[model samples]
Target: MKEISPKEVEHMLSDGADMNIIDVREAEEVAEGKIPGAVNIPLGLIEFRKQDLDRSKEYVLVCRSGGRSGRAAEYLEGQGYQVVNMTGGMLAWEGNTE
Candidate 1:
């Protein structure tokens, strides 16, 4: 699966790039904070919530660490959705959050 560093994602946001960022961490985890504009879709619910995602749009997946998002990316890719896993996930994110 495709991967991108948190710094790269931060730069993209700073540049005002239109991006589809999905946070696959659980609700409780997300309550802590998340990248601005990132939609929360816990890893466990990805299969059910996937219909909400547009296959034509490329998405960047995130989790507490890279593992869950990587798995999400694999699943989404298998289903033909364009996806990129955010390497190191939130742990490495030094960008603004909401």
Candidate 2:
């Protein structure tokens, strides 16, 4: 699966890139903070909520750590969606969050 660093993602966001950012952490975990404009789609619900995603858009997947988002990226890639796994996830994100 393709991967991107947290700093890269932050730069893209700052540049106003039109990419989808999906946070795969649970809702409770998301309450703490998340990348600005990131959509919450916890890992466990990916299957059911996938239809909400646009297959044409490239997505950046994130989690508390890199593991879960990596899995999500793999799964989405298998399903024919373009995806990038954020290497260090939220723990490594020093960007602005909402």
Candidate 3:
């Protein structure tokens, strides 16, 4: 699994880079705020959504902190999906969330 900082992810989103972002945080947390266009698939739901998640593209996993995303990234990587753990997760994200 790869590791990406908030700055890099923010830059990519701003530059309109083609990428998939998944928020591994809980639903209530996402209800408070979340990256624009990010998919809200909490860590607990990841297993059931494995096949639904695209394997052809890279996925960025995020959480309140970095722990959950780290695990999510590892799992996706093991499944042959190109995924990255968003370092510092949402706490360090400078991007707008709504």
What would the TM-scores of all predictions be?
A: 0.99, 0.97, 0.96
lDDT for each candidate structure: 0.97, 0.94, 0.90
Question: Once superposed on the true structure, which residue ranges of model 1 sit more than 4 Å away at CA?
Answer: none
Q: Which stretches of candidate 3 lie over 4 Å from their true place?
A: none
State the displacement of the C-alpha of residue 51, model 3, in Å, after optimal TM-score superposition: 0.7
Candidate 2 Cα lDDT to native: 0.94
Residue-level lDDT tens digits of model 3 in 67-97: 9999999988988888989999999988898
Ranking by TM-score: 1, 2, 3
TM-score of 3: 0.96
Please write out the lDDT profile of model 1 over residues 1-98, one tens digit for every residue: 99999999999999999999999999999999999999999999999999999999999999999999999999999999999999999999999889
lDDT of 2 by residue, 1-98 (tens): 99999999999888999769999999999999999889999999998999999988999999998999999999989999999999988999999888
After TM-score superposition, the amount by which residue 23's alpha carbon in candidate 1 deviates from its true location, in angstroms, is: 0.2
